[model samples]
Target: MFMKWKFFDKIPVEGGVSYQDLAASVGAQGEIVSRMGQMLVSTGTLLQPKPGSVAHSRLSLRYKTGNSNGSAFAMLYDDFQPVFAKLPGFFGKYGPNLPVGKTNIPITFASGADGKLTPWEVFAQQGTEHIEQFGLAMQAMTGYLWPHTGAYDFTWVGKYAATNPNRTLIIDVGGSFGHSLRANLVKYPNIPPGRCAVEDREEMIPSITKAHANDPVMENVQKVAADFHKEQPVKGALIYFIRRCLHDYDDNDCVNILKILADSLPEDEPQARVLINEHIMTDPPDREVAAIDIIMMTWASLERTVQQLEKLADRAGLVVIKVHRAGGSSLGVLECKKASRS
Candidate 1:
């Protein structure tokens, strides 16, 4: 809390600020902020360059407020205390196993919406801020922190777009605020915005529309109000891209979602694609991957491996063609095609 309130990228690197002053800046009690600063200092997250004063430590520099520290943005996902507290009770009601679907998870139960509403629904009911925070937090995870642009080469899509200007080149399903589409436009101006589209839930469509209302970059980019759980309304697109959304669902739900895209593919073209972009955990699961996997447990979701994704694709009547991942990227694109026409 102290780190988010004060250390947000605006802290001075060489000078120490008094805890009392820092607390005053954030309108908090002095004694409490002082205590928290001392605790952070002990943990090497803050430095006592001088007595009674604190400065950003080597590790805490990234936590500066205005900066895009994905870790910091994630810590703001919500008050997770209640969520973790409900874990045992949630399991007791269900069974002692990893969660699979969207409903009745730890977060839903903690929010007092278990079996009544999904987390997204719960967030929507709370207010716009909650939903917006969740969206920005997720964007932080995939947009800035561990961006997929580096992991996979998308410039080739631009080349493809140039030749096929009128074809539906990409459809980003469940894309929030059309970030991916905007990104593609920036990278490859050859991409015809009119030929691209973003499909999301009904409630979220307004926000997407508002975001692109006056933005020239997304002028002609199409927006569709659609649900991935149901059949994909947009058909025969060159790229049916689902980015960072499947992990929100379980194996069965994921298979169903993938099947819709597979069913919508242009069989004769053979180039129509179903690309799933998400983190693919290593076989042994590295520290970061393991941590994210646990975080996903909040909603009974998971960070899957390529092999696991292959199984899910096969179940969905899609065949995994290849997984594209560059070195140092935390996410990958699972290139897929329809398993069979019949």
Candidate 2:
């Protein structure tokens, strides 16, 4: 039903679309369309004011054309679902241990050319539309939470930028589309122009540029293409901000990513910080956090607790200075700095 009619894309948000009209547009039989429409209505995705016509529900509106939430749904349904289907067999063979090296479930289930690619590589290979959709989905996922400003104060960084003549103020490593940076710019407009930079894979630069082209927030934001697994190129940045990026890798990779960032900080500059924005799993975990933990497991990544994060930081020669939790949400800003050599 999702693929056939592009129901979410084609249906008008303000009014109902008839089942017969939807079926004709998709070239599907009327009876089948009716059945699927009824099923969707039953699932609360659509509302049936009458027998043959369906209207958008609040839930269904999210998947409308040009909506990031819809893009996210497409990424999960079209891309991740196949990997999920292979999980039972994957666990049967690999014993449910976190996949490492080349034992990726997505690759295992993927056909032909994609069978050999890592999840990141696979996304890169799919071209621009796929990458943009994935990014939009990520933004949609975090839209419910408090903005990044609410979680981490940028005033200090702005002040630091004002005083520090030569130093980079912020480097958003693995930051896709500069959403967090854009938000920061909106919140703290005084942050020095040309002091902030965003790094992602080479494929993502153009899209990032286009995404923030019109916004004054991104006017001075530098877009650099660098792999996060390697040493971060821009050095001595006062703040290296990583939001929702580390949770995509396993523990070892997470340690390495942090270590590289940690190594880049100037030893004399104690104020330099690495801000990690992600979900900190609760003691009695919330259902949303628990559910996402399982989803992240598909890629062998995970959401970390405060203890887990601390350990990860310690392993990377960094110390967790504070964990700022947003009120009424599972998100946290884990502030870390280089461990003092005592």
Candidate 3:
């Protein structure tokens, strides 16, 4: 059910279906394919041709690696066109309001969970297989969310940290390979060593450390093998950062992860902030944001809207103090604070 609409990139030699037609046959609305298709085209990542005639419209979109049937978008289109031609009323039958090939509806992962697989447990169990697919998904996602730098409102954060470079602690929790750190470092020269730290899985430390060996500012940048879901290592860092990490799990998982994060901080810091980098879906349903919601659903994750994120923060014993829309899209820079004891 989940795989029915996963984007496929290749053409089938024999299926005789086109991507567009398959999209039509499955009762998928034009907006879904158009949005996803336009995204691929906009990034110059891939090209897709709309079939000239209904006869040549059907295609197969084989999403997986070993699919013997027509799987590519082109193939999917080929497969789709014929079905539509044969049954002229398919589009009218399902219509845009119905769920034709909608990807995420939450029911999918629950089925897996019924089999006793928690989301991350599923990831940990599948290990490399899941990671590889997830990584590819991330790559495609990054492209769609172009100008990724704008996603975090890093400019504002850097400017603020620059005011007290020596005292500020910029900890990128779950920061993978120091990429975001470097991005911030390059933008904000006022920040210095011992100020920024990156914490991630133990397995990633060596390579990340080696990569930063020559970085003078990062020399004091502590890199630790830590889990944000269990506990944070630092006492009361000025900022605890998480980028694209929370959306990988369900609501309960996020609550537990945030609880661990909140507990790790000290009670008496002048100011402590928890920054989450993620997309906050639009309420009325924008094409791109809705598309990602489906993707997250398939991966056993959720991308909350601004109100929902704030609510999640409150549940975790923190308050959403501020939100910076660095770009118009779903991504936002959320700053949270511990509930005031007073």
Candidate 4:
């Protein structure tokens, strides 16, 4: 909290400052700042090259302003902290099994709307700053950990887009700031511009546009505002790419979202695909994946296994075609198609 709200962020990254000086700069008590500084240093974040003097360690440098990791820190401080505080009571009341329907852990505890609103809605009510910070945090988390192009093969999609000039290539559902789409386009230049589009909430359009304003890849990437829970507006796109979206909700809501995508597929185009990019839990669960699974519980969601994804796909009237695992990473690109009725 001190780092996010005060001392750590205020101190110069290159130079060392005494804890007392740092605290004075932020109007915080010297003793409190000293304790926090020592904690950070002990944890391999900040460094004290000289006694009583603190500076940014290599790791701490990542959390400076304008850095994605910095945004992540802000997100942790502003968003998750409150929700996590309520976890004990929530788990005690609800038990291990999460509630069905739209009521989620974050909604149950963090929402002021009497468990009526989703986390996104709560963020919306909090205004733009909250939304922007969340977006940045997501960017930092994904960009730093997973290389989107390396994670999934977009060659086939690019080839299809190159050949089918009239058809849309990729529709990034809930794509914030077009980061995933932009990354794919950068990797696959053969995929023509204007053939790709991104759909997000209406409030996100301006920020998305501004985010991609100067990027040549996004010059042709269309940005549309639409709710995912409602019927999908765009139809017959070669691929509907959803990354880190479904895990935000429970199984029922996941089914609803996938069903809408499935329903939008062109009847004649059996080849159209829905690509889901998420962390897939393994048998000997990766420690990080396991940790995320528990953390997602705070939002009434979980990191699903392959079988779990398949079952969820089945419920949505879709068939899981492939699970493309990112090499040496827990992230998987699960490919699905509309289930055939014989």
- Per lDDT, the best of the predicted structures is 2
Whole-model Cα lDDT of every candidate shown, in order: 0.77, 0.80, 0.59, 0.79
As a whole number from 0 to 100, the lDDT of residue 44 in candidate 3 is 47
- Residue-level lDDT of model 1, residues 1-342, one tens digit each, is 764575434457878888777777878888887787789889998889888788877778766543335344544455466777778898898889887667778888888788888877877887764565555555564554467465545677778877766678889899877877677678777777888898988887777788788988876788899989997888888889898898877888899999999998986677778889988899777676787788778888888999899999999999888899856766888989888743
Candidate 4 clashes between residue pairs 3 or more apart in a chain or in different chains = none
Q: C-alpha displacement of 189 in model 1, angstroms?
A: 3.1
Question: Which candidate gets the maximum TM-score versus the true structure?
Answer: 2
Error of 2 at 30 (Å): 4.3
lDDT-wise, the better of 1 and 4 is 4
TM-score, candidate 2, is 0.87
TM-score of each: 0.79, 0.87, 0.59, 0.86
Tens-place lDDT per residue, model 3, 13-47, is 33333446647766776666656555544554434
Better of 2 and 4 by lDDT: 2
Candidate 4 structure quality by residue, lDDT tens digits, 1-342: 654565657768678888778777768888887887788889988888888878877887667655667888788777777777876666677676664445545544665453577666678888886787778777775653655667778878777765667877789999888788888888888888688898999998998888778888897789999889998889888888999898887899899999999888777776788888888888899887887676687776888988998998899998988888767677889899989832
Candidate 2 lDDT at 29 equals: 90
lDDT value for model 1: 0.77
RMSD per model, one decimal: 3.8, 2.8, 11.7, 2.9
